[model samples]
Target: MDQAETKEWSRRYAGKRLLRSEILLDDPLFQQLINTSYFTPVPSIVRNYFQTQCQRCGNQKRSLFGSIPCYSCGNVHVYCRKCIDMGRVMTCTPLYEWTGPEMDWPHHSNACTWSGELTEPQRKGADCIVQAIQHREKELLVWAVCGAGKTEMLIPGITEALRHGQRICLATPRADVVQELLPRLQQAFAKLEIQALYGGSRDREATAQFIIATTHQMMRFKHAFDTVIIDEVDAFPYTNDPSLPFAARRAIKPEGTTIYLTATPRQQHQMQIASKKLPHVFVPLRFHGHPLPVPEYRMCYTMKKDLATYRPPKAFLKWYHRRKHPERQLLLFVPSIRLAEGLSEQLSDILHDCVIQAVHASDKGREQKVQQFRNREFDLLVTTTILERGVTFPAVDVAVLAANHTVFDEAALVQIAGRAGRSPNDPEGEVLFFHDGKTEAMGAAVRSIKRMNKRGGFR
Candidate 1:
């Protein structure tokens, strides 16, 4: 097209259009052109028009209201026509949208179609969280029960953000949780770009429209999102580290919103909400279309000092054998990796054709082990709290060995119990806390879960 035609087309297509041209900074012809033209006097009016320093390059030079040739690099610096249209130049580079409003972008249409009904409290809490996000609140704490569909409730907020052209992140503290969420989220947001980011993920840094990551990955992002949803907000890394909170805040835009989903909010966060310092919502029911199973705690006080060295507690072994089904699996939660491995070794010999597997955070084949557990290849799997919140295994009975372990706090115990009855077909399952002695925290955990269930009419 001729210069006149080009100018007319540019004018017609004016406001902040994304250009797809390569900037030639080092081409011989462009360099020569710039070198020869660098000395040419910029019009006095243009010289004083307005100056802008390149944010990336830090070059302070004369600025024009339109695309001008860079004297140093010969790259074209396109300017917003509004300034030129108004016949005024400014000192700052005009901000333009390379892409139109986010809503214009195509999004994945997958959504939760599960027909399960939420209890009244669950519904109210979920609605509160959704409303907070819709209004762009700074922070919200979703305090729900162990089995409440905290992740599922965030679906509406995620969909709304995607439809509005906003970027979102669902970050958890565990990789296994990230894996469990991928398929569920994929099925929900089928049309949108969804990427699961973690250490072993192939697309760790993929520029997806939606991201589900672990808490550790939060540090890599610097103001890269519009909405940040931290699932298991009260879980490890997130609740323990002040830095993770700072990183989470920094990951979002200045006007961005954050949503914290957890069955158990930390004491500090709870105190803040109690004092009306932080906004809060509460979900007291499970989403499996049923009430949460009240865990039965039994003190299997054996005189044996080392539970691993002695034969597995007779009562615990009895419960395991009775609950074991050929097609069903059981998860045995031990206190530490050493105990987990020792139990796995001992249990392997007692049950015929029973594959007892142990998994921990530092285990090399953690992913493979989890996959096997999910596939029901193993009859029983021994693990630490690593499998607590993020994993879901239907038709599995859970046994908490040494439940009084300090690490098995209220939230951890609740989450561990949650793994038992996730599937509707397996809505009820056994959760036994084989403790040597009952601790106050254990009583609190049981009471907390029972209260939530009672409030949700699960009794």
Candidate 2:
């Protein structure tokens, strides 16, 4: 039980846990470390109808349960289906966690060299984080508007944390955002060991001081990060699943600070803010000192009916002609994949000279389509909400065909609108919502953007 024998391994994962099967070191040495009080084994699957839980994800739902014949224990076993993609977990599964000495700073890297300037509101948000770190706060929210440069607001605090040799991780909700953000973070944190972990990432072997990963990847780490910053916390899967937040907490030290960055927060967070349970800062302005693209509501009756009859919306076609001569990149957001394909083909018939391409989640050439659009190979991109976030096209004009549809919610609408006016050089662009009838979501999105603009002193 020599402390010196396991010191090196303990240093890398002081408060973290890993699956027993994931222990990568020599087997004899791992056993030695276990004997030396450097590791603890936690049950991966918890049992019972009322109390059955996944220790890794804190999922207690009966719907996530499935039974199998245990090979090791030779009995019926159950595991969580929610996180089954990560790995199967059963009653006999051993989730090894490091229960070792507190982290020691043998080396401190220089702060990130990112020389970007933050806007006044963004600076205030960044300052809130610096204060959070100093006070050792548990959680803080940076509730900024879309296109608010939320990532830039994290730079100061993340830089300071790195200078202090505190392990840091910034997790996003999706792989697209991770790919979109990786190169920028790499350039900003040039001197630091930054690792980007997504599906099939090549740089997973790097000894990371800063990690940019999707929420799914966060489950693989336990108590590993000292400062955990989760971006777009209100996005799809993270918003819908409780397991993700559990995974988020499990990925950081219990005492480590957590920050959630989002343009849209859940209703619970709104209530928490009102009750003063959550400390937060709101940045209502975009980084470029521009207002969010306010949506203009236009009635295009029988849009779905027109699509079904292989007819493009007369209103959209009329608007397209008026806006077409300028040759701006148009993103026509449709409600579903089927509509995108149908409407794109219908649109191609009317606008023969214009290249209109449709892209959706299951589209195998989704990336290629987006790239081609960026390269100006297409005049218009008819897409589903898949391109609503984590993508940018300079000076693009956006229109939501059938914006009243349930799929085009306020957050998605806001994000789709955000895609229009991102690049500073082209700060003013149109965001039109052409629908059969406007819904509460459409109305709310328009009002929210206007209110943000008014708050930002927009004329």
RMSD of each: 11.9, 2.1
The TM-score obtained by model 1 is 0.71
Residue pairs clashing in model 1 are 102-165, 103-165, 108-191, 108-192, 109-191, 110-188, 110-190, 111-188
User: Which candidate gets the maximum lDDT versus the true structure?
Assistant: 2
What 10-residue stretch in candidate 1 is worst by lDDT? 15-24
User: What RMSD value applies to candidate 1?
Assistant: 11.9
State in Å the error of residue 412, model 2. 1.0
lDDT tens digits, residues 1-459, model 1? 355643432222222111112122245743443354421111112222466432211224443235666665667654433223222222223322212112223444444444445556667876876677678888888887766667667777776776566778888887878877898888776656689888788864346768898876665455567788888788887776555676677678778888888877777887998899999877766675677777898767781465749357877877776764546688888888888888788888887678889999889998899888888887799998888876677788888988998989988888888788788787888888998888887898888778878877667
- Candidate 2, residue 25: Cα displacement in angstroms equals 3.0
